[model samples]
Target: MADASLFEVDTDELRRVGNTMVGIGDDVAEVARTAPMDGRGEWGHQGLAGAGDRFGARYRYLIEQLAEDVDRGGVSLRGSANAYEEMDAINAASIAGLGMDW
Candidate 1:
């Protein structure tokens, strides 16, 4: 296996991926909110319209859930990038201290 120390986090790439996810989530949310649905009417059309309403509601719910999940994933990725940087700094400080004979 390769040495773990050689592993490096590309924070700029991570941030770009995260931003992309966020944009996708936003687009999904917007589409879900704005998409047109069938209208209600008398006779058989009413039943079909009712069914369509139910299906549309479920669809919107699912889309919103996916959007939320994707947005959270993006936020988590960005947070991880920041955490890795902080850990790297701590490691460097610790290594520097070890070299000090005091």
Candidate 2:
């Protein structure tokens, strides 16, 4: 798609993505809040930490999307696409502090 921004055809798709991300984030947070805690439960923080990890992942996706839209002055189409995946891989690598951290 020559001259296509990541959002050139349908900006609404991005909004849908964003809304989905927010909804998931909210769900995660709510679960963390309401879930029962163990005695002396520093482990309860794992749920909240997992939620933050999810939000960070969603934010990373948004950033990768914006990068695709940027074009970077004639980068190859495949290169542009690959960049986003690589960004995701890097983000996934850095995720931490989630119980088993899975």
Q: Choose the strongest candidate by TM-score.
A: 1
The estimated TM-scores of all candidates read 0.82, 0.29
Tens-place lDDT per residue, model 2, 1-102, is: 212333233334444454555555555554444323223234368677676666656766665555444433224333444565455445445654343341
- lDDT tens digits by residue: candidate 1, 1-102: 011222377776778888888888898888779645745444267678788778888988999999999999888887877777677667767777899421
Residue 15 deviation, candidate 2, in Å?
A: 0.3
The global C-alpha lDDT for each of the candidates, from Candidate 1 onward, is 0.74, 0.47
How high is the lDDT of residue 99 in model 1?
Answer: 96
lDDT of 2 at 1: 22
Model 1: per-residue Cα lDDT at residue 22: 89
